[model samples]
Target: MPHSLPPAAPLRGRFDRFLILGAVCLAGFVLPLNFTGPPIATPAIAAELGGSPAALTWMTNAFMLAFGSCLMAAGALADGVGRKRVFGIGIAAFGVASSLLAFVPDLFWLNVLRVVQGVAAAAALSGGNAALAQEFHGAARLRAFSLLGTTFGIGLAFGPSLAGWLTQTHGWRSIFLSSVVVATAATVFGLPRMRESRDPAAAGIDVPGSLAFTAMLAAFTAGVLEAPARGWGHPLVLAALIGSGLLLALFVRIEQRSRRPMLDLALFRYPRFIGAQLLPIGTGFCYLVLIVLLPARLIGVEGYGALQAGLLMIALSLPMLVVPFVGAVASHRVPPGVLCSGGLLLAAAGLVWLGRADPGAGWIAPLLLIGIGAAVPWGLMDGLAISVVPKERAGMAAGIFGASRVSGEGVTIALASAALATFLGAGLQAALPGHAGRVAEIAQHLGIGDLAQARALLAPTLDPATLIGVYERAFGHLVDALAAATTVTAVLVLSLFGGASAHDIANTHEAPAARADGRPERVADCGAHG
Candidate 1:
């Protein structure tokens, strides 16, 4: 039988939850910094390399796809091999990859390095939560999760600023170098004190299941990301989608029967868990749409430099720093459903407001609302997700939640890119009405300097002001679409809260003794020998 050890004792004495928080927070800093840093230099990088417009996106998407697909395996590995060991390995890999990225000669090599970096990130992110869940349970667990959420918020909040400063002072290569330094520091600080948490007997890594799931994720993500460039009907795109579906079916079948599955499908039985998963997906879709588009719009359409755009974008992260503590305090007194639903609603409202922001509007006010709105949902979602799962399976739960958020963001970006392209093409046609035909003709000529010649042909008649207006309108339309999606998420979260409110209230009123031990003691059963 799986060991049924009591939940780990709440941190007592000098070494408490705070130490664990600091250690894990150090590991958390590298991810958002690496992920968002590249995008801040997209225009510069593209210009310098003479790369395709779409090439810039791969810097971020490559990482997201690899990170999302590998998280499940990372979680299971942590369970079998030990969280600290897995974390150290991941941190080391990330540091090496980051160092390599600093010296990459071209975009292709950079993408290759990014994929490696993503795998390393998966190991750290997946294991961090698992280790925390194992080390701290009950109220202490809640506090630990809140701190993790805050750390993430802080990273996102400051990452762009850091990237902007680095890119300005030392160029884009500096961003990768920064990652190397941070990852190296985390490895050094974390390795000595980090404890092992995997319960070996219950934590068998399902290699076949992991492989199938990875194929499914990779195929589906590739289809989604490439669909904008290659129409959805294209053969390769269609094959990827079909293959993903089939592989996913196979993964489910394998997991259902596996002696020890990588995913704990049983957790979905809880409404809270289901809501937590879906809400993040919805919120992620909105969040990525805004974060990706805002900087591009500022830099490309508004003619702001990379640093200016990045500073404006910092609004997205600021609230992330403050909101989680609010959520943490509320978590102690209020039901998570209320906090989550309210946060989603706030985010929806902010997106709608942002959708209507004038192109020339003063930046501070709009950005402040956007920052606060984003922070609240981000702050609450992860903690709420972890709260719904039992301690033994927290790693699996965290992996699934993180994966869902990333997948949603990836799909959203693909769809948004297609929409923007269609809109921009139409706008360009309007802006260059008289020269449109000539521009198209030149574009298709395939002669030397064809693109430059086409630009020359269209340049005289293309009204810059009108073109900017069109792009802004299209951006607004995209933001509106994001707002709609966020609103739908808000409604779903509210409905969940309504449905579960009574049960939570009942639990709240239970005597202290009954409620104090409401969570079951199942740590030993988690495949850990100890």
Candidate 2:
């Protein structure tokens, strides 16, 4: 059934607009909080649930995979149905899922509930954002989105400390319960006052494209996450990796054939657009992968409690709160190519510094440096994504960028985790040559900061200090690889951005009709900073 806009009078009222922004921001806040909090609690959850390494990884990956995969589809649904309605349903569903998660009996159910929460998160994020777009225009829209971004940053920055306190004080489950409260508040405050609006001409959901994309992401992430335990040569792991490629090919074909495709494939023809896509992938490897890995290492390997681990994480995440504004401002004076590539180069250096630093006390400076580097491009990428395409196709640009950012984060984190686990497993095998078969299981435990469990599983004679040393060495190797990957990405992005010429900049500003072919004539240049 189609929905139409409600009365303009109520929506125009200042109070209603405030309520709408507040509600949307609240939802935005919870999503990242939920995302970042779980990794901090992974050790606690493991201590009780006693899950396999793959299961532990799924606890986080399942939510991210579902969240990233469903985002575009959720946006389409919100547009077709009522944005307000979709937002309400999403927030309500998120609350229900979160409440259930607080009491989840095992890791299986925890991951199952997380998937539900992720779908809810997708609905809430897309619906709320779309609704906000309707509620505000021009300057107000920019300010509203800015606040929304800040709200998300605050949550991402502070989630670890808050969740750590909760985990230590109440239990790991309290973290979910807290989200339930926030979700309820969002629904109650925003839904009733918000005006209902829908795009009457919105395209129907692209089921084939959606399924293929989601499956591809899930299959690839699952294969990576499972590889540490199952081995890269395992038939299922090989099948999954191979199937992901096949799914990708099918997805491209489906998108090409669709009448109103979810993704606009034509955009990829532009080099600038391709470079814009690389921004998130670079940050994913350099920044997001660390967010998941660092907390576990601090608590389990470094002997910090959950609270201490969370406090330490603030060094890494705190810069996200302010450095993005620096990036935004620097875009004016510094060439965006310089700013972006420089930021990434800084991050690469920081990663190397971090890998060499002593385990616990020597981390803060490098963590802050990495965060600052990542934040520089983080703020610019969204605006850059929109500006790279024609104004008429801005929505498509946003959707594509959004999908790439989130999905790339999930895939990169999974790949890095798998590599780290494999490295750790190899170290364990070398040390305990007699029990080679159990190396993967021990690596799994050690990976999540369950050092006690890992110690128990291995030979009784191996000292705790020796095991910690092995884990640290493996982690350092992983960090070194991530740094190298980020550096390569930075070079490629710089080269791509360097290709832009003054003529291309002028072409991006020209009206579509100005071109002979009726398409945006050329890719954008650094003027994308605008």
User: What TM-score goes with each of the models?
Assistant: 0.86, 0.89
Q: How many Å off is the CA of 114 in candidate 1? A: 0.4
Instruction: Estimate the lDDT of model 2.
Output: 0.79
Cα lDDT of model 2 by residue, 280-355, tens digit: 8998888888888888888888889999888888888888888877776666566666688889999999999999
Candidate 1 Cα misplacement greater than 4 A, ranges: 4-17, 360-363, 426-461, 499-530
Superposition TM-score, candidate 2 onto the true structure: 0.89
Off by over 4 Å in 2: 1-18, 136-146, 387-398, 498-530
Q: Which candidate is the best by TM-score?
A: 2
For residues 274-383, write the lDDT of model 1, one tens digit per residue. Answer: 66776666656556566665666666556677787777777776777777787667655766666666776677777777767665456556667656666666766676
- Best candidate according to lDDT: 2
Clashing pairs in 2: none
Scanning candidate 1 in windows of ten residues, the lowest lDDT window is 521-530
Cand. 1 Cα-lDDT: 0.66
